[model samples]
Target: MKNSIAFSRRSLLALTAGVLLTGCEQNTFVPPPPRVVEVAHPVQKTFTRYLETTGNLAPINTVDLVARVQGFLQSINYKDGAFVKQGASLFTIEPQTYELQLEQARAAEAGGQATLKQAQLDFQRQATLVQKDDVAQSTLDVSTATRDNAQASRRQAELNAKIAEINYGYTNVAAPFDGIVSNHLVSVGELVGVGSPTQLATIVALDPIYVNFNVNEQDVLRIRDVMRRRGMTADDLNQVPVEVGLQTDIGYPHKGKLDYVSPSLNQSTGTLAARGVFSNPDHALLPGFYVRVRVPFDKQDALLVPDVALGSDQAGRYVLVVNNDNLVEQRKVAAGPREGDLRVIESGLSPDDRVITAGLLRAIPGQKVDPQLRKIDVSE
Candidate 1:
């Protein structure tokens, strides 16, 4: 009876230990819930197709102000970097000397006029006397020759006077156009235009500025194809609108039109040179600035997603999408130009796919995710 009781106690103890181990295993091995992520359908809308490029700002006109006549620099009419109007006098180069030369020229012109009048009277008299046979042919010929010489001298004097007047006008240098003038290179009282033309200053037009860019051969062909389909003439090409923005700008705030397009592509760079003109009344855009440029081609319906949702790796750009089974999968995408805060997906994503826009780190590939549906803000 003692042996039976001992055997029953050991059996009960082993059964109690097994029950405890089963309970612990059931509680400890419970799997965690799926990671939660925000998912959204790519925004569908009519999007403008743009050929995006980087370009440089340039002045529409840049001219060097130089002394055309020899004289001392008498005055600098504009301050350094001052905006001036067209035909405004900007410099005076020894006006006193030029003024005296102009006076001498005028006197010479007056003398020439008097001599020409006398020659005309003498020629008339000589011709009348010869017609009446009152003077010998030789005498008339001598008078005619004298009158001709006087006429030639008068013509020479008139030309010299005109040249002198032109030189006098050059003493006062004027702005060729409305532009901002650079600092004077030569100081006051310095002799200029002695040997070669002296550079006085530089003026750059700022209102209508140029943005220069290059389009690859492929893009050029694409643009031409669109033009051909639309039956657009060369003149219509200039009417195409262009938009630009500075590097720090959020978007293209400046508007312009296509000013020029090269007729031929560059053999070495495989690019076509193009330029646009923008009206910058505030003088905000400056020359030599690297800016973002875009030309709208046409509008079409396209799928767009938040730019922040896109990710990249060695394989290129991609986005994460949750499958119908709530499993995360990476979709490689071909991205187009950015519109506002969204990026145009050229391909590789279906309209019905649920793209993970948030909790990207937790949503691993091939793992289940509890996706929370969200809507993309197209207004931005």
Candidate 2:
């Protein structure tokens, strides 16, 4: 009877221990939520959003040097890659052949002039002869006709000589404008004539360089709307202009004017070409360089947030905004132009709203969280 009583007591003790141990295991297995940081948004206006693109640089003027008259290249007048002034001689062809032609034409013209003078005198004599009856009517008529024929021949010869003079000048290849010339295609003694299809060299005007880029036709309509919104007159675009950017640097070095926008959209590209002219007296902007361009529209004030402070959901875009009670409120936002890494909010956010960025995954709508404020790393 004593043994039975002891066994019942042991069983009861084991049951109590098992129940206490089960409760402790459940408590130890539960995980606490993660901590998150956020920042308060201050309402302010910022003016610097840029339209980016890759553009190519080019000279304002490009010319191909061609020989007007057929002749053997006698000499290269200018050094290869030399800067030439307008009307500077670049090459010289064999002038001997053209010179001979000119001389022969001049001699023919002189002989014709002498013949014309004699004809004038003979016509006068013939008129006098018919009136004084010193010669027959038929004889006077014959002399007059001969004088007229000689006069016509002299005029033709004078025209031929003038043409010859022009051909002689063509033997010297003169620069068309002030520019840098390319390397010589033919040596001094090489043959350069009508048979040669390409130009002997090329010249490009580098000063006051131009940058060319393309923009979508849809953007064209928007630009025009901006111009009208600014109360711009027809002449205003000539005075006020758009600025450009370069990939060589992070931002545009200097401002430029919108010089050209294509009248019609390119059919193949479905875009229009735009050109901006900038003074490149320092030659800092070289020709044929690919660059990025930025143009500002107008200043506007809007709610904005750093890219890090936002999250993408199946329901478009939303952010975990913190309320005064530190509760996470999922607010849907309309995004606008991205200025650097920040997004301009078009709607759905107010001033001084704290947004959770770093620990976004740890947040849920209506969940309470510990709000820690932090700044973005500025080194990037």
Candidate 3:
């Protein structure tokens, strides 16, 4: 009985030890699973750098027509809003009074010519009498003076006739250019050109429209720097090509050339005024309409990454990159304008670097990750 009791105690101690070891094993800690992240290599391509801005459409030429002479407006020769050719009659002032004045001027001119002819005849007779010593020298001198005064009067009368003719021509108002004319400001038979030059109509050229825009000083300086690197002169700025789109249009569809750049920045707005000329043959672009302008200045090979890979902090913009060993690394990046779904990686990333595009929250910097390689649509 003593031997059997000793054997049972040993078995109980072994069972107790086994139970304690099992409890310790159950309490031991196990680490969580590794994070999963979608990764992609940065895309390299020849990217075109475009400066986009907004502007307003303007006419190449706009003029407000005004009467040049005083008269009652006889008639409006043009239909309202009609396209007219250069020198087409637009309005008519009363020509009867001008014509009558012209007739009186001609009659005065005729009388002057008759008086001049009589004076010439008298001077010729006096010269003959003086040569023959049949007339007094003082009398011959008086005849010469009278003839000279009559000649002066005849010339003055001729000038007065020309003035009358010009006044008569001014009665008919004509268009200064080929353009669309606005509605007549003065109705027929209304007194026009009274006291002040009366507003008659307005004209605007349709084809080859102008687009006006303003660029900030910073952008202007950047563009100048770019031109300097290319050895371009100030004259070459007008050669830069520009593209424009209307508010309803999707992309820049109308192509144009930059023909104007301000010599100095505006002090009030800190912007430089610029203009582009577009051949708007269809008259699709009208003055005062809003438009989008894009100026392409340079092209270069650049690294592009998915926009989802970017993150922002107090340090500005940053992106997560996976190293060759599949370790997550946070890199601060210099990002540029967005190109579709991708953002331009201006400085920070290399073409071969793998960027974490998804599951970024699951991945921690300095930690290992199961990076699932994926392709980014650079075209997007």
Candidate 4:
């Protein structure tokens, strides 16, 4: 009877231990709630189709100032890197030698004129003497020949005088156009325009600047077709609008127009060189600057999403999307050019798809998420 009582006690103790372990296991097991993420739906918007390219800025006009006459550079009239007006005196070569030559030419011309007058008078007298039978016909012929020779000599002398005057004027170097002048190449009292024309300075027009860029053959064809479809011709090239941005700019802030298009494509590069002109009244843009250029071809409706929501991996660019069941799913997307802060989705996404735009780290594919519907900001 004592042994049976002990066995009952042991069984009760074992049952109590088993119950306590089951309670502990139940207390430790806790299922986590769904992760919270901000979501937005893709929106349809009108997007302009732009052909993006990189280009270089150039001046509308550039000239290297050179001395046309041989002489010493006497003075630099303008300061270096200063803006100069058209016909402004920029430099002066030694004019004393040219001036003396001009004076000598004038003196020779005066002497020739005096000789011509005397010969004319002699010829008249010879004619009269011959008519009176006081002089020989040969004598009249000699006087007439002498008068003609004097007239020819006078004309030659006059031409020489004019040439000397022109050479004297060349001593003063003037700006060909209104532009910014570079530093002088020659200092004062330096001999210039000796054997060859000597460079004095450089000037570049900066008001209207040129942006040169190359377009691929495919893009060239596409743009041409677009122009045709829009009832535009080759003459309308200058009317086609373009936009540009410097490397420091966030977007295209400068507006311009296409001014030149190559008639033929470059065979080696399979590209066509094109140029656009932009007004730079403030002289903000400088030549040789790298810039971004865009030419709009057409406009159409496009699906766009915020760039923040897009991520990339080895598989390509993707966006996390929330399904109707509130489960996160990875959606591969083909992205196009960025417009403001939003990116155009070329493919792989639907307008109704809810994209997770915030708390991306907390969201995982095939996991439940508490998606809070939010609107995408499209303000630029």
Candidate 5:
């Protein structure tokens, strides 16, 4: 009985010790492994520096089509809003009346020519008679005066004929250039140009369009400085390449060249007016369209990171990075223009810093992370 009790007590002690050891093991904490994150150094690239601004697309030419002759509208020769070539007839006034007037002036010119010829013959005959002493000098003088008057009348008639022809030509309204014409402002049979020049329509040239924009004074100074450094003249400045894009475009797809730059800045606006000329063969661009403009001035190496990796908060734009200690950190960055899916880091970022490109949600600032170093595919 003593041996049985001793054995039972020893077993009980062992069981209690085992239970306490198990409790201790359960109470002890084991932290989870650091969250896995993908990190990469910023991609270095040679990117062209650009001056970006917003602008409006304008036609290179806009002219008001008007009637220069007094007449009733005869016929409309072109469809409303149709694109017409230079000198293509668009409207016809009462051409018959102008044509008749031109013919009348020509007839008067012919009569004057006949009269001048007769007077010249008479003057020559009288001069011959006087030289032969067959007629008096007075007769020769009268013939000479008659000849001069006839000559003057002939010149007057010729000028009148020319004027009449011009009026006749004005009876037909034609496009002054290749452009799209606005709708006709007058109906057929409407009397136009009776008192003053009447506006019939407007024509706008579209191809090789103009883009008007303004550069802030600061940008103007910057551009001028760059030009000076490059030893570029004012004409060379016009050769700089410009790019444009519509609001819906992904980037600047339309290409052009700097056509004009204002010599002075506007005091009220504090901007320098600028313009670019682009070949718009398809006429996809129109007048008064808001567009984005960019002028490339310089090219240099820059650091870029995935745009998705950027974040924003009260501290402005920021990104997550991993330090040499494999700890996550938040870095404030001055963001620049976007290149593809990446963004240029203008300031506040080091080339060697490992930016967190993926697994951002799991990467908490001030916490250790298992950084998986990877190469950024810039092409992607």
Candidate 6:
């Protein structure tokens, strides 16, 4: 019985020792987290000097065709959406009424002319009679007055005929300028009246189109500096080079020039209105199309860091950078204007330093990490 008790104690002690050792081994086996490092190699990229703004494309010219006279729509000469030229026939009002009015006026004018011719003969005869004392002065005077009355009547008739002719010309509705027409609003034989109150259609000029954009006050200052550096005056702005861009289904494809800059800034919006002109021989740029503007400026090289590596703290903005010893560090950085995916590093970092790009959520300041150093291409 004594030997059995001793053996049981030994077995319990051995099991207790094994448990303690296992706990110790586990305590030493803590896993390390992944680390990301920023690369410092010079990269080649076209840092486009650009300004982002919302803008809309507009036709160089837009006009609404409205009725000017009372008449039935005799014909719609131009099809809806058809390209039209200046003075092109668009609508024909029933001109039969106007034509008849014109004929009546012409007849009256002819009658007045005949009367004037007879009065002139009578005046000549009266003048001869008065000069030769062949007739009484009072009779000659009466004849002269009659001749003047006839002349006045002839002038009135001529003025009436011209008014009728103008009304008759209004029957043929012609385009004021070259442009594409919109849908027809009225059908043939519809009672369209003077001041064809309803628009026949809308026409927009597409070639050398205008792209309207607004410039912020700050950008205006920058542009002014640029202009001064180029020795440009107000008169020079009309000829200044302007570049325009638009994003299409196939990507940003269309190109144009900056042709117009508004003389005054929009007070309500606090922006300067500007325009860009582009060729639309194919009529691709329709008025009211949405597009982006790309305004290029002088190229500059600046210190930058990827946006992913940056973080905000109570002390402002900072980055987790892996210093020379490959250890995690908290760097308080001053950031400046953003350049695409990277931001200009105003201070607290150098071109030779590497900043941590990822693994930030898993990291804390002063923590030791198993660094998976991936080289970042800062040039992109």
Error of 2 at 23 (Å): 18
> Per-residue CA lDDT of candidate 6, range 240-350, in tens?
445544565442466766677888888898999887788889987777888877666445556666777788878999987666666678889898666657876667886
Clashes of 3: 0
Backbone clashes in each candidate structure, one number apiece? 0, 1, 0, 0, 0, 5
Candidate 2's displacement at residue 45, Å, is: 1.7
* Order of the predicted models by TM-score, top scorer first: 5, 1, 4, 3, 2, 6
lDDT of 4: 0.94
CA lDDT of each candidate?
0.92, 0.78, 0.91, 0.94, 0.94, 0.77
How does each model score on TM-score? Answer: 0.87, 0.74, 0.79, 0.82, 0.90, 0.68
Off by over 4 Å in 2: 1-38, 46-51, 124-151, 194-198, 231-242, 313-320, 340-342, 352-380
Give one digit per residue, the lDDT tens place, for model 4 in 63-83. 999999988888899999999
Candidate 3, residues 1-380, lDDT tens digits: the string is 99999999999999999999999999999987678899998988888898889999999999999887899999899999999999999898999999999999999899999999999999999999999999999989999999999999999899999999998988988888888999888898888888888999999997889999999988887888888889999888888999999888977889999989888889999999999999987889999999999999888888999888899999999999899888899999999987888888889988788899999998899999989999887663
lDDT of candidate 2 over 141-197, digit per residue (tens): 888888888889898899999999998998888888888899988777776676655
Model 3 clash pairs are none
lDDT score of model 6?
0.77
Please identify model 4 stretches exceeding 4 Å from their true place: 1-31, 103-155
TM-score, model 1 to reference: 0.87
User: Candidate 6, clashing residue pairs?
Assistant: 43-379, 67-196, 69-194, 70-194, 242-258
